[model samples]
Target: MNSNQKKLVKSTVPVLQTNGTDLTKHFYSRMFKHHPELKNLFNMSNQASGKQQHALAGAVLAYAEHIENPEVLINVLKSIGNKHVSLNISPEQYDIVGHHLISSIKEVLGEAASDDLIEAWTEAYNELAQIMISIEAELYQSNLKKEGGWKGWRTFIISEITEESSEVKSFYLKPKDQASIADYLPGQYLSVKLFIPALGHEQARQYSLSSAFNPEYYRISVKKESNGNVPEGVVSNMLHHKKTGDEIWVSAPSGVFHAGVESNQPLVLISGGIGITPLLSMLETNKKRLQENTTVWLHSCRNEKVHAFKDNVDRLNQDSEWLTTHVFYETLSQNGNDSVKEGRINLAELRDEVLIDDAKYYICGPEVFIKVQYDSLIKLGVAQEDILYEEFGPQLLHFN
Candidate 1:
């Protein structure tokens, strides 16, 4: 873009910071109305809760603030690109999104909107879209080039289903063609798309792989979100209701959150509630391949009834000589008994148990919990580079 266009986009930074989510909310509604088929691509649950809008708002504001040096946002771009590739987002959809976004800006700003401002925004959107499309294309090409991999979605049959907990179940999915599946770095997630009859549309949701990468099958442990009256988690609930022998569409594992297999540093895996899925994969993979590395799993949940993989972790602990596991229950059981420590998983409380000073910490959980765990680890003298965490939805990370 020219200097004048850049200036126009920069001037709108304040407005976007203040009203970006509102604009994106309007944009999504308009797009979905005009292009109902897109409902299959987007997570309506996230849309309803405003997470998708908030995420877009953050990205837009960031782009506007860094328009002159777009490379500064390369990390964010890579993260979004990975997700887009997992969702099979194509470059052609950029035009559809741009059209609605511009319309939303015009509708939201009303008389305050100007032709020059809209034109400048159009250019900016195109530029950003091109960058994202290019990155996504690279990711797609890389994934397709991997052994036993293909582009777009593949059919996977649910060969087995195991109830891990009252709210969580593990679905063992194998390729429908009985072919080998591409291997993924431990801690990555799979994007599963299924048709939801209630919404009258197909929906895609990313579920962290709960086990180590295997050519035979992938395991995703889903926590059914059926609390209260909120209609969110439509796909998760659908998966919970599904049985073995059902076929589901799945994308190759994708995400930047994973342990570095090459690193020989001690590994610390911390998780809360169902967020343990990806971390479990990391722990399992570490045990299988990197047995020499010292590993510890620190987890928190409501209680035994809700803890998903206690038996699995117990088996790993018994088999591995260098592994230690700790569980923190939020509340006691019905019998008011507890075998592990009581209360939330606080890093400070377990400082003595943290044997390694320069260990790599991997965390996954709710937004607030992840932030707390990250900050706590920092306070414990862990270098920022040694700590990594993944937020399930739109990343709101502000790396210091």
Candidate 2:
């Protein structure tokens, strides 16, 4: 904020740009060394894969790039806030992160990290921390304002578990209190926290609300990760282990990936694999509301066996004349023919088959998939404002 801080930020940009990955690697190693307990706070597999480390470095560099104007970082801050909320990252953890972050910077920069530089980074970290804390606090407050919302986590008894596919299962959850739950907007997500004895404390994950918001209950479809890494998505595997009447902790619904129910424009929802959860909710809600003019749903999966909610999607399509649904399976069945296609969804297919000229597009999927779709949409002449996307990681969908 001050002249010295501004200078430091500007100088740090080059260093960050050049050695961002190295700095992040060192940062985490040092952090874990000092506070081994905090290791559980991060995804170890993500660290091993270098995705989380690179993401953190990229975020730090981006913050520095926009240090002179904090407003430019609003989208980044919001995304981080959502992720933190999903992780159940506490305000207290921010202090721990900040302390280690500064130390890491100094350790990496060595003599070049002067007193003024340290002070500047410290101030910047404090500023970023304050912004995140305030945003998360607001999110928490909003969740609590809703009727079924509660602070921290609340016990939700699993009423039923239906296997949607070999890898995916849908869990029907109801608050143990028996009171009416707050209705969430279609495409929103709920943060589920799990207390793993092996991992210690609690770990959290976010899953999109797969069913239309009803006062009675909520539904989430989770696909078990078979790679056997990252603690198996703590919350998701926990749900898999649950059965009828099992109690689980769930936070209030929160997310910005909801549909524009108020808009009259055409809506195109594109998804891949487990990403169908949110889009399914939007489609179901639209069918119920009869707001189905010019709506298109495109989903991609590997095969019929792993494709979830097929029956529900088929039923919705058969029942709602206003909605059009398309499923693309990469692998062919015994009939030796694929339903729609036999490969990944690309811009060519999207532009040719899915996207409408004047439609508002909502895309959710893996990071690479979303990026490709986004670039294709733009290349196809769709305005930036017309495309909405949500990534699981801390990346800004819209920078401008």
In terms of TM-score, which candidate is strongest?
Answer: 1
lDDT by residue (tens digit), candidate 2, 229-251:
64555556767888899888887
Candidate 1 lDDT, tens digit per residue, 33-107? Answer: 999999899888888788889988998899999999999999779988988889999999999999999999899
Candidate 2 vs. true structure, TM-score? 0.92
- In the predicted model 2, the residue pairs found to clash are none
How many residue pairs clash (N, CA or C atoms closer than 3 angstroms) in each of the candidate models, in the order given? 0, 0
- lDDT (C-alpha) at residue 60 in model 2: 91
Q: Against the correct fold, how does model 1 do in TM-score?
A: 0.95
**Lowest summed-lDDT stretch of 10 residues in model 2?**
391-400
Highest lDDT model number: 1
RMSD of each: 1.8, 2.3
Against the hidden reference, what TM-scores do the models get?
A: 0.95, 0.92
